[model samples]
Target: MPGPVFLEGEKVTLRPPEEEDVDLIQCWMNDPSVWRRALDVNPTSRQQCAEFIEDVLQGDDGVHCLACDDSAPLGLVSLNDSQYGPDETSRARDTELAYWFDPDHHGQGYGSDAARRMIQYAFEDRNFRRITARPGSFNDASVGLLESLGFTHEGTLREAAWFRGEYHDMLYYGLLREEWNSQ
Candidate 1:
């Protein structure tokens, strides 16, 4: 299947995840060093990865895009778990953003590029007024990136999640359309 392009950036392009990406995703998600930063890093099999592709293709609650440049896939960026107001245009459309890049690709700014494009897509194309992110408090890189993108720290959910066998705070960040527009 031809993977439909979703959003593009100078250094990164986000596209609808296709079956061809499953192997790459499996390697990244199952790699211990890489998976630690993922939302769920459990050991995953090829079948599980295929199932994930299926879910992403369904696109009911969200969309998952693979970030790539000239050579290969760099990461997975997803905008999902959306909630809207009473009416379609009632102005309450909000969504959660989740992204993870392979550890090998870290420090190359792929995440930043993909995030900027995704935020633009959510605001201009999807009509989302607010975008939120829940990053583990200990993830300094993530927190720094979100802040740099003008995503304000909204609050902290104390001990709201378990990661690496310990309870960790979940930091909530919200970026309003106006905030992005001003940027």
Candidate 2:
């Protein structure tokens, strides 16, 4: 919506999701590994995913963009205005960055590339003051990606998220515009 038409990386392109991308979204979201790492076991129905695409196009709280490459659909990346709740992000001029990559493309730097592009757009194009991200404490790859992009590890909420059967921590990361500019 308010973001760019397309963001380019070396091996991927992040573009606004289209109606045709619904099926591809379903496929990636339904992947067991994706569910485990990203969605935390919440199953997605086709109808719900259709609604999601509509929401994305309409800028439903700033969710946008699907990542793809010449190979196939890779995953989804978003710059959401809201982080934990409607109240929090509503007060701050900040956005939350979230992403997931297909298991097949893991460790190929697609996630980092997409995130860096999103950060650049948020700071330069959108004029955002800061961006925040929260990743599951056990998710090392996500933590590494955020850290590599110069996001500060703000804190960890202990046992804040319950996934599968047990409770897991959530690590909060943030990058300020001043910090990004300094880099």
Candidate 3:
């Protein structure tokens, strides 16, 4: 319930997203290489970024954190306590984990590190029973990160999303508290 706070790790730190991050996220959102793999690739303006940070900061359903070091903005991480399904009958008390690193920082394991911290927060701090992640099938880096963090591939929804002017499959991954603990 408390506003999101900075989370530190050996490689990086996760902090409450700030206004300065808007321009950085905007740059990433606008990059063809970055957004092409994202579920939403449309150009996002400063206002949208502000609204997004506000939503993450104020919304009860989630926590969003910025990944940074002593240098500059590296990426973003988020954990949402909500159901993927829209209807109550199909909903579960689940947390959704999402993350992204600046393309320049992609191969350095920042995304995986951030994701692991969020997963820890969900299972340990938040007492979540389970966490789920969905990455585009073509997004191999994300798939690898989730797998390394003990997320099992649930299944792929065939052509479940339309992005970057094409229909893409959505690969679902999940980790239960027991599973996370065992790992």
Candidate 4:
């Protein structure tokens, strides 16, 4: 079963991943349709999935949540501490947002509703200054979702991602606290 609700939206609820959710997460991780657009395309083992939940998802470095409705979890959303590049100074107040939904649940507006709620928590409760998102150029759904949430298309790294035996560009998006408040 999923943990108690952590965040709620109109069409979905966000909660922490529980031990029982390992199998489902593993299945999603290994699904080509799901991993193709994510940064890691490698096959994921059940053990790895378990470790991911116990370590990364539950770790203090970020806020990770499972997006669910009244019935079952539809996806995962997170706000991780941004990793600064060599030329950039580390901004502790900034976070990198990411999410992925089950292909079966796509086009239902659940992803958008969950993401919007996460962004609201980031700015209103966590007091994060800015949130960034990086989606592969090939993932039109992800790009559209980010844009719909009012994230600006800040830049793109050409052919920075390799998947499905080819390279694809990675698009960057950003949303500031003030910008979100204005919307």
TM-score of each: 0.90, 0.86, 0.87, 0.93
Residue 58, model 4: lDDT of 89
The residue ranges of model 4 lying beyond 4 angstroms of the native Cα positions read 84-92
lDDT of 3: 0.78
lDDT of 1 by residue, 1-183 (tens): 247666789898888787887888899879876677665757899998889788764456576788988647888888876656424465568888889888888878899999989999889988888999989897888998899899999999999877789989999999999999999
Instruction: Give candidates' CA RMSD values in order.
Output: 2.2, 3.6, 3.7, 2.8
lDDT of 3 by residue, 1-183 (tens): 112447777687888766656777778877777777776756788898778767764465588787876546688788865665423233465878987778899989788877888788878887777899999988888998888888999999999988766788999998999999997
Top TM-score hit: 4
Off by over 4 Å in 2: 1-5, 83-91
CA-lDDT, candidates in order: 0.83, 0.79, 0.78, 0.89
Candidate 4's TM-score: 0.93
Q: Write the per-residue lDDT of candidate 2 for residues 1-183, one digit (tens) a residue.
A: 323448787777778877777787887778887877774576788888888778764465775776777535677888887544444335566889999878998998888888888888888887778899999987889999999999999999999877667789999999999999888
10 residues in a row with least lDDT, candidate 4: 84-93
TM-score computed on alpha carbons, candidate 1: 0.90
**Candidates 1 and 4, the one with greater lDDT:** 4
- Higher-scoring candidate on TM-score, 1 or 2: 1
Taking the tens digit of each residue's C-alpha lDDT, what string does model 4 give over 76-150? 999887775211245657889999889999999999999999999999988788899999998999999999989
Candidate 2 vs. true structure, TM-score: 0.86
